[model samples]
Target: MTAGLLPAPEDRSADQGVRVSRSHHAARKVEVTSPKGTRTWSASALTDHGLPSAARRAYEGAAEAMAATDPSCQLPWTLLAGVGRVESDHGRYGGSVLGENGVSHPLIIGVALNGAGPVAAIRDTDNGRLDRDTVWDRAVGPMQFIPSTWAGAARDGDGDGVESPNDIDDAALAAAAYLCSGSGSVLSESAMSAAIYRYNASDEYVALVMAMEEGYRTGVFIMPVSVTAEPSPDRAGNKGRPGRGHQNDGRKPGSGATSSTKPHGTPGGKPNQDDPSGPPPSGGGGNDDGGTPTPEPKPPKKPPKKPPAPATEKKVGTLAPCGATWCLDGWTLDLGGEATLAKAAAHDYNHNEVAGETNQQELDGLSGAKVSVVVSFGTATVLEIEGLPYP
Candidate 1:
């Protein structure tokens, strides 16, 4: 497995469990895991991370509106959290670097501090001084709204005259609006999921959003359902054939009734014991006709049995760098030679020991290097070269 790429264990607490404040409705805690330990916070952490108060308010307001739009909209809110985490680390912006020309840019910085440089800054409009757009142009606000798309979707969700991308509330509201768009409804599992994918096009984004939404619903979200009745097949056919009655008796012999039996009061009623045409019923003993009892059905013949599944080899021990380990069922190998030999031993069934000794000798002769070897219950071979130059 690659280092630092594995997901953190889910049981860890978030950010030392520090709880941040939020609006009454927005007051929910989030747990995050970090090297320092797990820490917990509220929506207020967005502000502490350098998001302006106005932006935070906008995000909260948008969430409320989305909750009202559809309970499923919460799915988008969870996605919003992940978007914010990845794009701007919860709204801590302005960490860009400058290019050789001495202007800041929006490119990603290296892990080491000494290796970092200033990124180019962006211009909001056509000012023409170096001509770059504002850093916000790259990705701005709580969910990192890109300027080109934000311009069309951004609204005065809080009724402010100027709509700024850096504002959390504005960004969140824009995200919700984009997700609730026509195609979004069909795309999302719920209204919220649609909005999340609209914010960022990735399955990871969807998973993160779903996780956060699960947290939110447990706190204060509620969903409602609606129902409608559709026309039945009979009703639909009746619409096409205007005068068709429920019972159509106009038909030739063998078409309408034939030899089929009907219940006592049906249109073509039969003369069964329940009908008036039969003899008067005897007192609870049997039918007045005195019929004999029918015998039970015979059992069905059994089918042939199927064969059992093949058995698998049991692993007794592992082959290591020093030498092979002993096992009743198989053999092992040391790491001085090719990995292919070990792989072959693990899989091969006929050899009952290492089977690639000859192949390893031949490989060593050709490459002028030592070949690796592995012996086991099987005869599969794996090969690799040692002391080779880099390409």
Candidate 2:
């Protein structure tokens, strides 16, 4: 026997308006424009940190090697730099130097122990313990190597035999190798995120790394959108099952499948109906022996109707300042002000701010506008802007 069909549930009441929170609305408004085109993004998208000088050099050398060895391998240098920034704070660890006697020497160490020299010195008493030395082993060097994991993964990135943890060049090379090796070599956005998780071993590490990576890539830090806003039911023409308040089975009208009763006067069309071709009918419109007449030929099937368009509200603009420019929608407004430029930089605009530059001078004299400023470490640019009264 054929199974009975289940009825679909009723759709949720639209009268009970879905109240979108302010934060959700704000998050949806944030977006970034790249070569791939404009995309919606959250505020936590990119990070503003940088790699230590030592680590940066190491990463460059390693990237060059990878490029030479594997043409298809592509390591995002800026992403690596951003990772370094969050991991080691550009290798500004305060510690004492170690002498030839193997005793700890006292001296506050920054990015370099001396010019082009290996970082040495231990500022904290727990220098020997990886967990206790927050400035040294805690954060490690460029690529943010954990002291516990460094021994197994560290390598000489510059082709020099020595592998120093605090050396930026060595650290960066090690990071690149780690990222491009084993499960990390794929270089997908997800893979990069997973590799970062391996580096930190934190559940949230991927989100942090992605945010920083994206910031370096596009000069904007955005958050991820929540999944709640998407419609629960799959609409017609969508590539999934129509859920909940829709057709329970694949059966739809005009799909060539039988539903309810067949067209009238078409005998034997319904299940268990007797065959009309074998004998004449006993009705009044008879043939030879008082049989009914045959019915007309079946008509051609019609195409299915198109589904209604999904409802969409007008998208509001987000406030993003880069350098001398602020962006909203597709428009950009330039506001030439050092304070404004600095604010944009503080917020992680993807350019640098340098004195005596044309853009810097331009920023020194602007007013009445929202702007998107892209500032690197040393140079700033007015990428775009909007909503400004300035001429």
Candidate 3:
């Protein structure tokens, strides 16, 4: 039973749309690439996030710590995975990778926070130590921890004792600790959302993360797509950010994870006590401390996994319309899972906003073009779209 999305939006909850309960499969020793480096994970669920083994392992550790720290909180691994995906694409940013030692060789640093516009403004907390700015601090590592917050919350996640921010294992622990600090339980949807809002300073950001997390958890990636009159040159990748039906919106993704609005030394960001959407108006998703150029270091490792053999790539949909042709603009749709073009979203990212048909009547002609599709074991919801020009 497939159905299109409602134009007005119903629950406004992130858990809407296709849901994949869980995968019951044996663990495979697969290696994946991240900003830190290629590492192996013994767990099957962790690898489904399209993340390298190292990142998944770090996230597993983080979720474990959070659960242990607060049994009532029971934080899920996908929340942190969502954060990692949004913040730095599983630490694969800047062409870096997680080393076997847990260090993000070459380092993962964000732009300087100049206090102008959306970026937060905080002076240097550490003098040329963690981020090496000595002036203003930059969010560091896979989880993007600000120096000010990292100073007090940084833990030896790998048990190496040095408490290095470059280590993904260590960073995961610190991030989990911060998420659980506000005395809030991430168990409930509302409470979990509130916790995510504290991490970044925007409601949109939280939604994007939660959406991605759901996909990772269920192994069903949702790719939101739009059909346009004119050709879109920016097809291979998004203009500013990554993923579907979402954009940066001039606000940093995780700026408020540990903003100044909260009492100093606390891991939690400026919690939106009132909105559960983002940081305080004056704070939250602002810039980092300041701007200073930091040259990243590269390392030798097996590059990220390549697409599987063409023979392995599966395709859905009947050629029944006989010669119907389809054009796709987003990332390559991986047809490795039990997927099919099942329903039309009735809307997608249009004019930079979610635009769609209001009723079935409005979508009259689209039925002929609608092709139920799905891709298993990959990321993306709305990938390949088939249509015919107006008659």
Q: Estimate, for each residue in 93-203, the C-alpha lDDT of model 3 and write its tens digit.
A: 656666767666678776555443344666788885777787766778777787776665567787765776678888777667656644446766555556665555444
Q: Find the candidate with the highest TM-score and give its number.
A: 3
**Which has the better lDDT: candidate 1, or candidate 3?**
3
Can you give the lDDT of residue 237 in candidate 3? 34
Query: Which lDDT tens digits does candidate 1 get at residues 1-391?
Result: 0001112222212332323222332322232221111223333432232223343354567767766643342424444444444344434434443232211245321111111112122334322111134321234444544444454456545556656555555566666555544221322444344344434432223333443343332332211010012233554444333322111112221121111111211011111111111122333434457664343444432312211111211111112222332111122222234443334232222223445544333332333222222222122221211212100
Give the clash count for each candidate: 42, 53, 29
Report the Cα lDDT for residue 83, model 2. Answer: 56
Residue 178, model 1: lDDT of 52
- Please state every model's RMSD to the true fold in angstroms: 28.1, 26.2, 26.9
Please list the residue runs of candidate 3 whose C-alpha ends up more than 4 Å from where it truly belongs after superposition. Answer: 1-49, 223-391
- In what order do the candidates fall by lDDT, top score first? 3, 2, 1
- Candidate 2 segments exceeding 4 Å error: 1-55, 69-73, 93-139, 183-185, 223-391
Candidate 2: C-alpha lDDT: 0.36
Please estimate how well model 3 matches the true structure, expressed as its whole-model Cα lDDT.
Answer: 0.46
Per-residue lDDT of model 2, residues 122-199, tens digit only: 233335453344443333443444454455446666556676555566667666655554222436754565455434
